[model samples]
Target: MQHVRVYTDACLLFVEHKVSWDDARKSCRSFGGDLVMIKDSAKQKFILDSLIFEHWNTQNIWIGATDKAKEGDWRWIDGSQVTYGNFANGQGNNHNTRRFIFSDGSNEDCALIRRSDGGLWHDYPCAFGLGSLGYHYTYACEFTRSGYGTTIGPTNQTGSTDISNHTSSMAPITSTIETMAPSTANPNIETPAPTTAMPNVETPAPTTMANIETPAPTTLPNSETPAATMSNIIGKKRRL
Candidate 1:
């Protein structure tokens, strides 16, 4: 299917890759857009009534609204205050601010459009069940003549799973190093100690040193000096 659909004012790119809210925003931004911001009722209706129902099959989709900057004070990615919110009843309580509700244990700081009740908006945890927790959904990117916009939703495809994979990768590298260090150091150190002791046992080094350094230095200098002196004397006698 065509990934992008153009509108009168903006263009919408429907992405099938599921990811965390942060990852979704990044994906949109990568192509010159942020998450789709339904600023007013017209934009909201266009998405819920037409775009989503027509082109998408997922139940939930992330939006650009977030209260991460300040609890209970939600804003769009452009830092504009959310003036019109079509929130579902009891969904955007903004309760306990940054604290978790032990029942669900997540701070519902980001927004999504859930299609169950005619596609009303709801706040969800930014991280939710994505990024190694193994859950994610498709998202959309909106673009204008000026720039870009973004969103995401449930149940399939790989996007941000690699975010936490570094921790898993570190485990094997650490184990391999630990295994190699001891094996190499122990054999080299222990073998050298025994070989060094064997050299001490043989003790033949003093005799070889005595022959190498002695007699040669003493006899060579004496023999060469006399021969040179005799040659000089013979040259002088011949001249005389």
Candidate 2:
């Protein structure tokens, strides 16, 4: 099968195909890509005019463009609607008799194209057993931008102190369009509070027991009874 590729600078996506319309679309979606949809006269004309050869079996290759998601609402696979469509005179008026057929066969509701002569579009039957232009069954494809290039900013920051202190730098920001200056005039700008010194504590003296008072002991009664007992004993001895 022959591989066909289509792209435009205005759209970020592109489509290429070498398989049936269904397979082509599946491949596109696998990579977050879609088949090319001719939305306007300009895009249609651009696609037709850019053709270099006519290897496509049908007039147009199936594009990611379709109204299948919402019948009759015709939208590209990317959710874009048909702002423009080039239907050869009286085309697209099939009275809804056919939904998926292209021009090559019956029952094919996909799109088809001729890469050699920049042919117009028509419905074809997708189930028809007819082989492609070269009997090839696979198409490898991808999308790309025209005249557009991507730029990457520096990822490392070992050079200048300005880069290290981006918040305080005066360099104009070029990555985005909107720019703003730091609020240097605001009087309410926050300032860190000062830290307080810790207090010095002195060790206390040891306690002593000498200052404690002791209670005095009470004295017993005098021995007057013992003296009288001794006199009585002496008198008894004298009597004995």
- CA deviation > 4 Å runs, candidate 2: 1-17, 53-59, 93-108, 114-118, 125-240
Best by lDDT: 1
Residue pairs in collision within model 1: 18-137, 33-148, 34-149, 34-150, 35-150, 36-150, 62-152, 137-153
TM-score for candidate 2, please give it. Answer: 0.39
Candidate 2 — number of clashing residue pairs? 31
lDDT of 2 at 36: 66
Per-residue lDDT over 115-213 for candidate 2, one digit per residue giving the tens place of the 0 to 100 score: 433455544433235433332122223344432222212211112122111221111212223468777776885888876876777768886658766
Best by TM-score: 1
